[model samples]
Target: MQFFAPLVALVYLVAGAESACTGPNARTTPPPGAIVVDATGAYRGSFKTVSEGVAKLSTATGDSTLFLMPGIYKEKVTVPPLKGKLIVQGYTCDTTSYSANQVTITRAMAQNDIPASITKNRNDYTTTLLLKSSNVKVYNLNVANTAGNVGQAIAMKIDGANYGIYACKLTGYQDTLYANQGPALFAKSYINGAVDFIFGCTRRLGLSHATLVDFQKWHKVFFCTRKCFAQMLKQMKHILVTSVTQT
Candidate 1:
């Protein structure tokens, strides 16, 4: 059964290739009032890093948006608690899928990177993108933890509720996505990992038209929903493959 899981998932992916998210369409320019981030310094007055743009929103009172220009951001980003809704949009040519995503936020951090003395959840420390705010929506970005074959490297860790992750790609080797708490929705996204990548304790989670590929040998545990009381809605069109040839 485990050997056939990947094939089953691939069939789902092929069947749902035309499905699209209900979120906003892809845009070439930043939306009005959005904070622009251009790593190449091409956009005048734009922040050079995602963290810098997020930092600017530390004291924001109303809805905020961060528009990341096309580039690879080699830094970890943390979205702190915000007073209102937040949207992080990345440059993409196609809005329907993550295949044409032009922006990638990557880091190579793992659980071993943290100091031994820290007693807090080390999983939070290994994430490339950490969300600590509610009412957050992320779109069209490739978020990766390049800590290859390392123990417990997280691509994205959501500690807040009401998150909507759309049209993005999340890649890692272990524990790729840590949905610590959620009433969250992941739509039109691709999540790739090897072991227990989608583990979470979220109460209500939805995977709509998404594909999850675990490209390593089958482990005893996959999707570790620990004491979660979860309402996991794996839509009929969603894909969950146990293995794939890593390129």
Candidate 2:
């Protein structure tokens, strides 16, 4: 009886350790009614790509959430205009920061890759994640464009209002994050690039505990804007702005 008691205690301890890693915000599992995306094929009946998961949301009514499993998804995702709010979250054991993020959406597309005659703005065409929907939130995923230091390549282009980007990493070589239109909040995230990395025309942008890094000689952190208002929290390091053209 005494030997069996130790085994019972060990089982409970193992169970407790597993439960400790899960929480409301931890996001180890998908939320109720969330569209699940698993690129690794481990989850049956789940969408195989991020794009497919987002496409499901286009026809979905009310607020929708897309939860991605832990894997590197090599694809570009675009969030089209929707009536309700949209949440795109990656699997993580710690939601408070992006360090524990297990999912990444990566693609390589440059401005020159798209034909100039097709669109007036080539920046919109080169983005890895293009958001055209309002009231959207992205959390705990690394969004990157691996287009190298060749011309203009965008990691993300957000043309949405009332959006929140939390605990994620956005990286590229040039023209990384295009905050084209926004009354948006970027919190606890990392943005890295070189040459007009965080360019935008956002009217109001809030940066709270976010890190921005530029790695090139021509270090122009920000570019064009129309009456831009930036709220930098105390935790934010200096924002090196060499040029800001008001339009």
> Clash number for every model?
0, 0
> Residue 231 in candidate 1 has what lDDT?
43
Weakest 10 consecutive residues of candidate 1 by summed lDDT:
227-236
Q: How many backbone clashes does candidate 2 have?
A: 0
Residue-wise C-alpha lDDT for candidate 2, range 1-247, written one tens digit per residue: 9879999999999999778778766887888889999987788668999999988895546999999999998898889999999999899988888788889999999977888687776777788999999999999989999997888999988897898999998988788988888877888888888778888757567777777776754336767643342332322344432322322
> Candidate 1 residues 1-247, lDDT tens each?
9999999999888767534322356466888889999999999889999999998884657999999999999998989999899999898757778898989999999878889998797787888999999999998999999998869899998988899999999999888988888888888899888878877757577788888776776452246543452345432245554577767
Q: How many clashes show up in model 1?
A: 0
Q: After the best TM-score superposition of candidate 2, give how far the Cα of residue 198 lies from its true spot, in angstroms.
A: 0.3
- Candidate achieving the largest lDDT: 1
| CA lDDT of each prediction against the hidden true structure | 0.83, 0.82
List candidate 1 segments past 4 Å from native. 1-25, 217-221, 225-230, 233-237, 240-242, 245-247
